[model samples]
Target: MNVRFEKLYEETKAAVMRYVSAHCYSITDIDDLFQDTYLAVYKSMQSLTEPIQSSEAYVIGVAKKVLARHYSAVRRLRAQIDVSLDRRSGRGLAEETADSVDVEKLAGDRELLDEIFELVTVMPVTVQRAFYMHYVLEMSFAEVGNELDLSEAAVRQRVARALTEIRRLYKRREQL
Candidate 1:
């Protein structure tokens, strides 16, 4: 209801919607992400220390957080389902060979992966997709770039920047 918020929304909503839509996998997710993005932006606006320099960037940042949260939840749910299915199917030779795995190490790795996923969502939309397609989806830079309408060099740059940012965030967390 704030006048400033209305102005910010009017200025940035399309950009925010585009950012969310680009990252989402399905039409249903697009609507959910778009609405959640605004909700996050509204909540974040209340905690601002000063007037934002770029409303579009601020809204995009909030959208990134919202998207991160959504992905984390989905990953957790998927993992849970996998575990349950594995239990139902019983242990195969490969699964049985995992008995030597250290629970603590697995836990630590999961935590690190979650942190990396969080950092990925902090990047710009293009960079995020570039990183996801190139790494997670195992697409080559040229393929990813072609799909995204970017040059191969541009895709490489975005993926590199995304990794650098993730490493920076990881190091920052380590120091904390």
Candidate 2:
């Protein structure tokens, strides 16, 4: 809309897209992350201080935070699903103990393996959507906000909260 915003968009869009792509795996995910990043930038443009010379740096910082949050939430949900599956399988106590240990080990491996999609589906609708846009789709925070009608900061916060929940889930799994 404004000249400054337009200029900012043109100058940083590719960098932002690359940033998102580095964190994601798919073309669709890349597009989503790119959009989210820009949408976040758009919403926060008004609050930025003057002489903000490094737009790319700031946007990348935001993108990192967003990616961390998304991954965290997905990890948490995965932990929960693993736990639930463990319970439903109704293995004996000794078997359960062995299974639990195996599951914890599995979780660690899953994290390394980047089996995120399996866990991403368990989040709440809004969270999942945001998660998909930012992580799976690789949309930037701003892009996520624009598609979902939220602020970039709000998207960042959502992803962060999701990560927190996920960490809690993993900790619980490890303890069990």
Best by lDDT: 1
Model 2's TM-score against the true structure: 0.40
Q: What would you estimate as the lDDT of candidate 2?
A: 0.61
All candidates: CA RMSD (Å): 15.8, 13.4
Per-residue lDDT for 1-176 in model 2, tens only? Answer: 47887887788777676566545533334565667677777778878766557978988877776666555777546534332453323222222222223444656566533433444444455566778667755788998888667899998898887665544444444555
How well does candidate 1 score on lDDT at residue 168?
Answer: 52
In model 1, what is the error at residue 31, expressed in angstroms?
Answer: 1.2
User: RMSD to the native, candidate 2?
Assistant: 13.4
Query: In lDDT terms, how accurate is model 1?
Result: 0.65
Give me the displacement of residue 112 in model 1, in angstroms.
45
User: Considering every candidate listed, which one attains the maximal TM-score?
Assistant: 1
